[model samples]
Target: MYELSLIALIMPLIVGLLAGFIGSKINKSFTHWITTLGIFISFAISCWILIEVFLNPFLSFNQNIYEWMSIAGFKFLKRVF
Candidate 1:
């Protein structure tokens, strides 16, 4: 379970890196199409993930990515939580 969650977290970064690398080698028109298609696919997957979370909240986990300390006396934690 832990491993699966870790994989889920890392998969997007890996995919994005690969896509960006490939996109850089392609023509502008082709790169635009590829990027658009990738974004659409990502959006679809995100919707599915949201629906799954709604249907089964217990299956999801919160991941905190970072924290920010503001000089305006505001402390914020950047998170997937």
Candidate 2:
């Protein structure tokens, strides 16, 4: 379970690094498109993960990435489930 979480975290970092590296080597116009596409892919994967978790709660996992300072005594946090 821990390993799976680690992999889930690392996967995005790896994709970002690879996209940046490849984008740097390409033309500026094309680089923007590549980056946009990467974001779309990530968003699609997130939606899919959400659907899977909704369909089968027992197999789902959640992670809290970070928190923001409280606003009006209300804390803000980012999480994945």
Q: Which structure among the candidates has the greatest TM-score? A: 2
TM-score of the candidate numbered 1? Answer: 0.47
Which lDDT tens digits does candidate 2 get at residues 1-81?
A: 545445555556766777778867779787666656666666666666667767887885667779866799887888876
Give the runs in model 1 whose Cα sits over 4 Å from its true position: 1-25, 64-80
Name the lDDT value of residue 40 in candidate 2.
68
lDDT of 1 by residue, 5-75 (tens): 45555655656676688866768677666656656666666666767778996885666677666667776
Score each candidate by Cα lDDT.
Answer: 0.65, 0.68
- What's the number of clashes in each of the models? 0, 0
Q: Over 4 Å off in model 2, which ranges?
A: 1-25, 62-81
Pairs in steric clash, model 1? none
